[model samples]
Target: MQTQLNKHDMSSIKATIPHYTDVFNLTNTSRPSETDFRADIKETMVKYVTFLRKNDAPFFLSMFPIHYVNNNSLDFDFAFMDNRSSHKVNDGNATYTNAFEFLYDSCHWALAKANATSVKIVIGAIGWPTDSYPGANVANAERFYKTFLPFIASGKGTPMRPNQTINVFLNNLSDENRLFLDLGSFQRHWGIYKFNGEPKYRIDFSGKGRDLYPSTAKGVIFMPNRWCVFNGNLDDPGKVEYMKSLACSESDCSSLDLGGSCENLTYVEKVSYAFNRYFQTKGQASQTSDDKCHMGGLGKVVPNDPSNGKCEFPVEILSAENVIEGATFGASGSSRDRVHGRMSLSAGLLALTVLWMIL
Candidate 1:
């Protein structure tokens, strides 16, 4: 079972006789390679290296080393790195035309500094976003996936590492809203599916070169189909503007931003979009005493779909009562933490039931 350890737990595990690290240790996630190696990082590396040398156990150390111009080996058994060529599409003449070539060069560069005779490589994350940025769109995302998926499925590897089978892990399966702290808005939209379990576009995951729609998540229940809209007249837009700003501050406004899906909306529509997002994000059912949807009497709840062409005003899922299907294994946090979250939820439900019985 995978459990994300804290700093203290990590130290304890390292000090323990039998090191309880995974078979493949993916050290870095989105760290820039240009930064100087910190003392703590060097210390951790020394400990891991000593452990590896002392034991004949089969363990692999993978890291994301991007700016390794010098051929200094990291001495890891395996290397995991990301190749985001789509982000460099608008670099004018320096645009990356071929993602495969870029990935090949990156892998080769990392291999040169590996210091090991044979270091396996895993293409950690590589995908394109369809929203939340100027250049981000469905066409570009589709183009990237169509080309990259087939290339990896073909098992052609790279120019330098030809005939070798490279394991490729797609960036994400669905869009996430809460990951904005660690990732950009464009990063949230990197999934093949939208936030509501709906397929964004057709993708052939089987790698047969045929485009097919992926299966949507099952048993997902959502809150009521009501939306908070701008009740005040458009002439007096000051209050509406304030409400929009407040709503955006409290909830996700990425989908209604400058290059977002709702960017082309009118002033009224944009304000309503922001209001509805805030309403939904605050748990459409109202989880707390202060979780109110009223936007200073300027917002009204209506049972209408505010979704425009290519833009969807989402009604978030009621996930608290449901057993989240695929929330088991993730890179977010530990299983213990996840279990505790579920337990707290279960306890809340039990208390509510007991209160109802008493009444």
Candidate 2:
């Protein structure tokens, strides 16, 4: 039960849910508690509750605040915490302890307000990153989940709230590089699977056995096998540094930043990493400009995978045209023939359409 007010009407939202007792207003704001922000939120809450009341919806509405709780009363349902402990905590015990502690505190406060244990709890988000920055690697993520899944399944709640059933949703399903740019680059890396719907590692959601493979998305198309690399024979070696910086700025260089998997790369390798990322991300379209491939004469297109050691130079995948058409995952393929096949099919379709128009 979470959605944008602008995106979905109340009726549309209700239609999707059979019966829900909780609704969350998790709208993100920079200065979350500013006067105007509070006023707008209060108005929305009033209207939302009023609508629910008219329909006899019998629901508890939760309003998420930035730092501190606002207007604490039984009228409000509960608070929200976008708990991303894996951003810093690498130790499994610490992460589990912190997550439950956060939930316990929220539960305690909500119960105190209602003066009873009738008030319930919900964990808005809990997840780990699969790449970018220190502690964001797949191994650490797998470690965290291995410890976390079992703890929740045990039904042993935190010290403050024992044996309480709290609803928990993992932070994300797959990597979306487009969202949360204001947060660090790691924001997009917080997926159980990589961007193209491939699993990073084995995970057991059931707590039965660590045998679950990631579900891959269907109909995923990939760019060609070609990669852009730094020119080895550049007249001006100084230009190489400039091109490296420029390429990183225009594309994702989080993999080359501090604590990244590629943090130990040589000067030339760093530039190549950035150049290849940009090339792969742009779909490797047939009509792509030569200038895009040329980093001031310091870039070159190569037909080889540049992934070295633990440093992976990723090739982007083309998602289905619409977001809603997307789903959760399982295959990977990239060849010149496959890419050419795609291009040929597209061109043939276009030609057919043109002939039909002429006729």
Candidate 3:
């Protein structure tokens, strides 16, 4: 790939090989020097490092401190870069106060063992999610980035590599509703922005300790404010359950799971959430007597918002197909065409731009 890119005058775009943090040790990640890479992984890394050096490429490493808290029962405070954490790891003269540095140096030690100490390392993906778990909330996400961004900008590097430049790319941009849930529901909620182009919380990308909301997408077209909600009727309990199951199976219902944002909602609210999700996903158009919102006479469309505290029943956005069709056929060469042309430009700008910060 490097050779082909070089031939095409694209040699400036370096090849980056991404790997998980677990490639360092099989048993534990906290102790760096006390562990060695698995035989198969070590062989692969040796070959990869050789190729990377030949092509002047960089090694991209993905680290997630949230996974340690969720999967390994690590201290919650230790995941953040704040120094007030009670949990600390003593490795020789270096005391590790945060999981980020612990994992970075762990990978550094593995690279040294592989004789790839000269190769550059880039953080390909690292960020906290805002939902789908108890620890995964807006406050925690804000707290994590508040300290982590400054630490990255500080250029303190790790115990193994001091004062070295670190390039990092945030894990994602927007929440993904249709993501696979095998790794955990949190995987779909790892976005700083909501799926509808709204900022989830305040974040200072400059790493200067500023508290302000990020820029939001402008000119986003949304569907009608009407929401499909469950009527106060419990005559047919079995049918309600079946309807909710069908709706959730066809749409996203991960937010209703334990520790999710909507976990505290009432049973009726949960059913309504599922039903509304399905209705919005199916497009809010009414066809004859049968509508998507008609859930066995238990569902109805309402103009009022059904959001309860933090649990939001979101309105779907206008489909891209409609936008393009209107732009292409509404006016051949008039103000309508110009207006839709700008809308198309805005839509193109809405394309995902991954945040990459170098420190």
Candidate 4:
């Protein structure tokens, strides 16, 4: 890749590899000389840094203070950028008030040990999730970025490299409902905006400490404001449980887990949430013959909103078919033909689902 870039006269494009905070054994925070890269990572970094130095490239690293606090059972306040709690870390003359700076400088120490102190560092991904775990909420995410962004904008580098410019990129722009859950359910909730392109909370992206929300996407089409809820029929508890499991198996139910937004919901409410989530994702087809809300006749579509406090029962947006149809309306014949082909494929899938239900 580097050779190709150089051949194309694009040597200015730097190559970077992402790494977590555990790249080094930061046992002695007070002494940079004592810090060393992990044994297995040492050889790799030594060889990689040679190329980086030759090309004057930057080292890319990912840092998540929230993960540190959650996995290590550390104080929650320690994760905040402006934290001044009793959990402050002292590294010689430098007093680290937050985990972000501690981890940032730790990477610098590791780079220095690799004999690549000249290589600049760029933060590849850093942001907080808004659900699926304790301390992962809109308020906490907002608080984190509020201080961290300004700190980044201020150009106040870590204790190891003071007053240096650092480049960073936020992890994501919008929530991903279908994201893989290997890392944790929180991975899907890291977006600053909801899946519908609405800002989750106030954020001053300019990093000037202004209380404001980002601009929302305009002209978003949505389904009707109806929710599929579990009827108050508990005669067959086993059937109800089976229906709930089936709904969750085909849709998102992360919010029903411990520490999640809907964790405190009653059993009936939990079942309703699962059913409604599946219904919404199916384009809210309660009125159609292929109704998703019909959980063995235990579900009902209600006009009244089922949302309670932070536990929101969201309405889904218009399906992709509508968007494609609109886009191909006045397009060239070839473009319309291609879109129609895709729509036919979607229709075939729907037909298969309906046939399977009949079977």
lDDT for 347 (candidate 4): 33
Q: What is the lDDT of candidate 1?
A: 0.51
Per-candidate TM equals 0.61, 0.60, 0.85, 0.84
lDDT values of the candidates? 0.51, 0.51, 0.75, 0.75
Residue by residue across 76-167, what tens digits does model 1's lDDT show?
11111124323332222233334344334443333333332244445555566677765567775665566566767788765556666666
Q: Which candidate do you rate higher for TM-score, 1 or 2?
A: 1
Q: lDDT per residue, candidate 4, 155-218, as tens digits?
A: 9888888898889988767666678987688877887766544567888888887898866543
| 1 against 3, candidate with superior lDDT | 3
Q: What's the ranking of the predictions by lDDT, best on top?
A: 4, 3, 1, 2
**Which ranges of candidate 1 are over 4 A from the true structure?**
1-97, 114-117, 181-183, 233-239, 286-291, 322-359
Runs in model 4 deviating more than 4 A are 26-35, 323-359
Clashing pairs in 4: none
After best superposition, candidate 2 residue 15: deviation in angstroms? 16
Instruction: Give the alpha carbon lDDT tens digit for every residue of 133-252 in model 2.
Output: 545678766766676667677777765566855556675565555565554566666667554444567777775447566454334455445778887765777787787777766667
Segments of candidate 2 deviating more than 4 angstroms? 1-99, 106-119, 181-183, 233-238, 285-291, 319-359
State the RMSD for candidate 4: 9.2
Evaluated at residue 145, the lDDT of candidate 1 is 64
What does the lDDT come to for candidate 3? Answer: 0.75
Cα miss at 105, model 1 (Å)? Answer: 2.2
